[model samples]
Target: MGTSTRQLNIGFIGFGSFAQFLAKTMTKQGHLIRATSRSDYSAHLGDNFIRDMDEFMGLEHDVILICTSIVSVSEVVKSIPFHCLKKPTLFADVLSVKEHPRQLLLQEVPEDSDLVCTHPMFGPESGKDGWKGLNFMYERVRVRDEDICSSFLNIFEYEGCKMIEMTCEEHDRLAAQSQFVTHTIGRILSEMQLTNTQINTKGFEKLIQVKESAAKDSFDLYSGLFIHNRFAKQQMKNLESALERVKGLLEAKM
Candidate 1:
């Protein structure tokens, strides 16, 4: 789908680290933003903050971005007062896993409202510099008013993100092999307590980086990747089987 550059009033459902990171860029791009979360982030958002969910729905934003954790996405989406929405709005998500949110939004959101499931594929630490060359994957689950969806997506497209359009199923399968595997390795490194050494190899340093980055994120994020993505379970099994094969090879050599 084609998109045009247009300023949008975007409302974030959750104002955590990831949401804040995205808000910075959207604000820089001159999109009006408002947010409400379980905790009070009024100070952070200033006049844009709406304390009440009912009032938040009344704001009539062109897009409502779901920035909640993957595990809580269902509860969060269900809690939204869709009937209170002033108009048909575009509902988008930035969860790491795609299929879950795509399904939840499809089930929970009103039929008239549009749905776009997206994963930014970078976080606060990684995208701190800029979104240039970073991958942004999305699937247009349901869309009738295409212009609003395109305009909202343009925010990322304009920021030098490599916009990738694919089915949610395809995204989950690929992410299981790539993102899930990376996190699993990072968690394993963390478990091993891998640390810096005077003679750190280039490969070891990269592992350290992964371990640190992954450790910084909540276990909830990692768990959600495994629990929500069907393909991730197989990847986990593959990881264990690969290690076992390696162990058997070492034993044979011994």
Candidate 2:
């Protein structure tokens, strides 16, 4: 973590749920933030601009944190002035998938700044429970500034998250199994929509509880991950094969 939290002025690009949550968390840590707004070119998340991302990006900061959805990540990256970003600007994103956006960010960020792709496996809405199960997945490739990578890792580490590093491609391919498959299955569970009235039992109630929790995220986000991720498409094919094999086994059992 930066010993001088007061010196960490950050520019953020999006104003979604996780962005707002992370802004509050970083603000509590005493760092100033500027953000871009759909309305204004620059604005502060607090009084000066208060949720205007442009003002945040205009300020001098240690990092530019973009907490946008996976689909919007690249567009926001391209819109920002990469050349003007201060040296050692640690650019980090909290998007779910990595490879595509990570490549896009790398192309824009100069050698002086660091571009990191991170997937925070835990949501900020853990409330009182805190984040022990949460994992901060990251990658610090052969970029211009390695210290920026160190600084980025420090931010998540200080926030009580477990930091795991891998290449962006590896991260994306792996997430298909880790994140996409589970999410796809969870969506399947939610779509089933069976209730206790249909089958009165604690087991059924418990299943709904788990299923709803997994499916609690927006449908758009789910579609983005399941549809955009290349590995996810393959996994679904694998799933179809499994189901077919299982059906054959059941028929043979007869």
Candidate 3:
């Protein structure tokens, strides 16, 4: 990793909406951003978009950021021609689940390359205004080049993100407790198909926001959160048990 925040050739493997959002910030910070993905995003990326994977790898990016969904990450990484990588680069991910991507990248990427498993906890909606104080969690799994890693991290630091350095396992455990549970309840409320009523309390209004926010994301994303993170299955079970206990208390009152 580079010690200073110099302009880097950052290439994105999946140029989705989330990737585009991050690219906007990095570009503003003077990093050259280029991308290749399943779809043609040339119109959105302008000259920065490279349509061919072979060509994308040949660009010799200082950092290769993987922005694929949890479910598709394995497939996407497997399909990549790593041999085409022009040089040893830092490979980072912005997946919601940490350990899964961490394991995948370690197994797939070249031995010489570095790996950083990251999860930018906020998204396009929460970060629409700016990334100030937003949680940016990362684990420097295999960092041979500290200067380059620090430089890439400086991009988020420049945006006022609360940089959190923790192990991928710890991240998954905490995420299952907080993020997974929140999404589970949001999905439940969405299933109820909540609608605005004549009389709405502040708490109820917040629930509506949760439902709307969760609904805005694809079912694939929600499922990926639940499916990819091993800890999430236990969290789902806990949620069910807690709901049952609440129902029992209510039944006793009745």
- Could you list the CA RMSD of all candidates, in the order they appear? 1.6, 3.4, 2.0
Q: Give all TM-scores, in the order shown.
A: 0.97, 0.83, 0.96
Clashes per model (N, Cα, C within 3 A): 0, 15, 6
Worst 10 residues of 1 by lDDT: 1-10
lDDT at position 243, candidate 3: 91
Residue runs of model 1 more than 4 Å from their true location after superposition: 1-4
For 1-254, candidate 3 gives per-residue lDDT tens digits of 11238898899999888999999989888899999988999898888888889988988799999999888999999999998987899999999999898988889999999999888989888999998899999999999999889889988888888999999999999999998888888899989989889999999999998888888888899899999999999999998999999999999999
Candidate 2 lDDT trough over 10 residues, lowest sum: 41-50
Q: List the residue pairs that clash in candidate 1.
A: none
Error of 1 at 96 (Å): 0.2
For candidate 1, write residues 1-254 as lDDT tens digits: 22436889999999998899999989998899999899899889887888899999988799999999988989989999988988999999999999999989989999999999998988787798998889999999999988888888888888888999999999999999998999999999999999999999999999999999888889999999999999999999999999999999999999
Q: How do the candidates rank by TM-score, highest first? A: 1, 3, 2
246 Cα displacement, candidate 1 (Å): 0.7
Q: Name the lDDT of candidate 1.
A: 0.91
